[model samples]
Target: MPNKNTHYKVKNLHGTSKDRYSKKKCECDNWLAHWRNNTKSQRTTCAVLECARKATVGAHVICVDGRMSNEWYIVPFCKYHNHYEKKDEYFLDSRVHLIPVYKLDGCKRG
Candidate 1:
């Protein structure tokens, strides 16, 4: 749940390269499932601050603050927001939890 004081700064990764990871399998089946299993929360609306649409995909994003620029994180997103261009940046709601898309050892397992 959001703490109301911890907004996450994120940017969509390049769509073309992001698609390449679509077929990879994790213990939870898909990225969305991975997010759910890891966060211990149910998917509701898109993670974007004001988006009201139901979340349908686990969109890949990278932190824009440079600390984790090389790592990808997954957050729930609607079909529309999931297609944002790489240059698009947004502040995710404080309640939204980011799940690491990959592990240093291997793909993240549930």
Candidate 2:
């Protein structure tokens, strides 16, 4: 049987998150709207890149499949960071690279 107390883990299956930004495309118009209200500006703390989005932690699609990552929330990446990723370069997208990559313990998981 499933852990009844852990039902919180299944909440984000259909893009049902507190913030819609997590499901938005990389270059969407509303991309930075949520963070504008946040005090962090665009600072990120994830291991993916040293950049920052409207969010410190971002909802990332998995490379293994067209699915959102069940374990990691890519964070702190600046707009330049996503460009590096689309180019398939080794500079960005480094897991907990030169900077500290702390995992978000409370982020909704798929």
Candidate 3:
């Protein structure tokens, strides 16, 4: 049986609740949209080396420090490499190089 108390515990993990994460995603849409529209090098090259696929999505490289970092390294990645369950393994093995997308001074991922 699922613990009824599990919900409270999860709310505190990584300084974020599941509800907060969802809310943040909605808030960040404008920032993402602006970035996609304004960036000159809308990266089409896949971060994974030797892959000829055109990249279409921004994939965040999870930071090593283990705290859910607001600072993220966004790499241009194809759909397959971005969202697959085995992405971490592929990243570790391939050591995908990421390009840093500079956040504009006034722009915030709120």
lDDT of 3 by residue, 6-32 (tens): 110011013222354324322234323
Question: Would you list the C-alpha lDDT of every candidate in the order shown?
Answer: 0.74, 0.30, 0.41
- Give the TM-score comparing model 2 with the true structure, all chains together: 0.26
Off by over 4 Å in 2: 1-73, 91-105, 108-110
Per-residue error at 79 for model 2, in Å? 0.4
- State model 2's lDDT: 0.30
CA error at residue 92 for candidate 2, angstroms = 6.2
Cα lDDT tens digits, model 2, 1-110, are 32323211111122323475344333322323222222233344322333343333333322222222454333233444334235332223323212111322222233
TM-score for each model? 0.76, 0.26, 0.43
lDDT digits (tens) for residues 27-97 of candidate 1: 66677777877787885899998899999888888877554546788898888888755367788987887
Question: What TM-score, to 2 decimals, does candidate 1 have?
Answer: 0.76
| Number of the top-ranking candidate, with TM-score as the measure | 1
Ranking by TM-score: 1, 3, 2
Can you tell me which runs of candidate 3 are displaced by over 4 Å? Answer: 1-39, 63-71, 89-103, 106-110
Ranking by lDDT: 1, 3, 2
